[model samples]
Target: MEFTRPLPAYLVTRYHGWKATTYAENHAWYRRLADEGQRPRAMVISCCDSRVHVTSIFGADQGEFFIHRNIANLVPTYEPDGNHHGTSAALEYAVTALKVAHVIVLGHSNCGGVQGCLDMCQGRAPELEETSSFVGRWMDILKPGFEAVKDDPDMPRALEHEAVRVSLRNLMTFPFVKEAVEKGTLSLHGLWTDIGEGGLMHIDRRSGQFTVV
Candidate 1:
């Protein structure tokens, strides 16, 4: 196969800047991570949106978080059918291998993927109903979330928060995760971030509401 596109000049310049600034300042820490291997304390599942900066939000450092990003940050039910499962694979590695103490499902405001699921559920996106659409199939995992919030006055925002709840429920479906939770070795948390105002909302397991944090 022949490649056509060249690297963007702006990205190349930014890489050089990082190498000289952040990389230089953290050189020893970077080398230690490379030699000692990563043992992140927490696993964070979040959206693939470029605007959702997980590190900046948590003020995390290198080797601090085991992160996984997917459409709507949704976790599907455990199928174990010997097929391609990215999210499940990450979860397994985080729990069984890395032994992350906490797993957080981070949803955000104005998520395009959640909006797509909402549109599909509302009969607006007919193409998403087809079998060939990858995104449509992936977003299907959030269908139950949309159903729960379909009648809400603010359907979009409600669905965004619901995605975190759905993911938290799905995390319990995995045997390893369930065992860890039961044994008090691991814990699950749900969070939603407002994009515009930068306010954080945490899901209260007791009240089932996304309360401001």
Candidate 2:
């Protein structure tokens, strides 16, 4: 499936502009971080959707947050499969090596991956005939959220928010995260960003609440 416009050429051209501006504007900060051996204090686990730009959405600085992205903003339970688990591996590094204070699962509205999972949960979508496709397996991570909130009238919205919550729940399955959370060294968060409406909600674990930020 190739496009007539061929985006690679446009992207390469854009990179030339970015290289000039970014290097001229921010290379010192990048060098300082390298000189100090610095790492970010937070880790953001977000969806791989192009519309949800985590850095720009949060107004982040260069070294502000360690990022891990995947479809549906998922974090699977710790599994030792032969295949590489990119998101989980990032989590392991962030928790153990980077020693990040906070780990946030950021979900967003109108996520196709979330929609697919909900459709499948409602039996409107089919089971995975090909167990090996990336999205087929990634959407499987949202099942617990659907099972938890399937009957709600706002099942779609609820599923999206609950996916963030359950992925936060799933984050605890990793031993380092579990230990860090228990000792109060690391805190977990569930966040939702509405791209269409332009609002962000933060989960208050203490009150079982989602407050606008």
Candidate 3:
């Protein structure tokens, strides 16, 4: 259980580089942010995959976005069970406290979490079905999404897009989120990133199709 350790040399060197460059150049902005607190315009829920860089994609500066990264970027249905729920907690804080104007679910092509869900649903990954499996339970949130694309010839890709759709649907399940949307105080969006192509696709809710943005 011991946690004390030195950071790897590469990461430490990178941190020093950032400190000397971006941090130094934006020291005043960082101080202002610390003093005034964050008032991000949007809340982005994206995958934990290192390849998906939300800030880089949007060219957003520090404190411009309230970002939450999780496996598959999945948002579970609203469940007030008095248990720990990281994604739900972040959503609540962002919608109720931060008053962010927009909430975006950012999924990506070649998402490992989506692929895992596909594998589990197809009986290819029994390990994920075990009750003790953390990833299995977390990905269970996307079961309905996987079902929507299970029969497709391109299940992985389809499920990736569906993950965004599923998250948007789940966001509405939260009473606070729904109220904000109904009141026109908040908006929801679904987006999928093509990692290899360096392109972005926004879901057309009306058409249920991903159109290039």
Candidate 4:
């Protein structure tokens, strides 16, 4: 197959610049990573939003995190019917293969996917109701979360936090994840960040409340 399109010029320039500067500065480190392979300690499931930088937030290095980005950072319940499952695949590799010690579901303020879910739940986004809309189908995973916080004064923010809880609950549905947790080899955490204020919150597993971190 012949591809007609070419990569954007600015990206090409940036790639060359990174190769000359950052990569050159860290040549030995990059070589070690390439030779040793990745041994990330944590698997961070975060949003696809451009604003939420998981590495920057944690001050993590290139090989420190196995990051997975998805709409609303949602994790669907385990369904191994032989169909395509991107997030599940990532989770399996992270838990069973990589043996990550921690799995963090990172939600953020002003999430577009969460807002879309709210709109769809409120009967506002008619297009999202269609079966053909991929985003709509994905957002369906968060509908239960919406139900829990639909009446909140700040439904969007509430649902954002609910998204993390929903994903954390869903993460347990995977047998490997559950087994790892039961074996004391793995732990799960839920976190939310305020994009505008650069604030962070951690969910208390016992009380299910998000407290400032």
- lDDT by residue for model 3 (67-155), tens: 99999999999999999999999999999999999999999989999889988998999999999999999999899987787788976
lDDT per residue for candidate 2 within 29-142, as digits (tens), equals 878988987488899999989999988987888788999888889889999787788988999999999899999899999988899888776677665425765676788888
Q: How many residue pairs of model 1 clash at the backbone?
A: 0
Give me the runs in candidate 4 sitting further than 4 Å from their true place. none
Off by over 4 Å in 1: none
How far does residue 160 in candidate 1 sit from its true spot (Å)?
A: 0.8
| Of 2 and 3, the candidate ranking higher by lDDT | 3
CA shift at 123, candidate 3, in angstroms? 0.5
Work out the TM-score per prediction. Answer: 0.98, 0.89, 0.97, 0.98
Q: What's the residue-level lDDT of 100 in candidate 2?
A: 94
lDDT of 2: 0.86
Better of 1 and 3 by lDDT: 1
Steric overlap count per candidate: 0, 0, 0, 0
Local distance difference test, candidate 3:
0.94
| Cα-based lDDT at residue 94, candidate 1 | 99
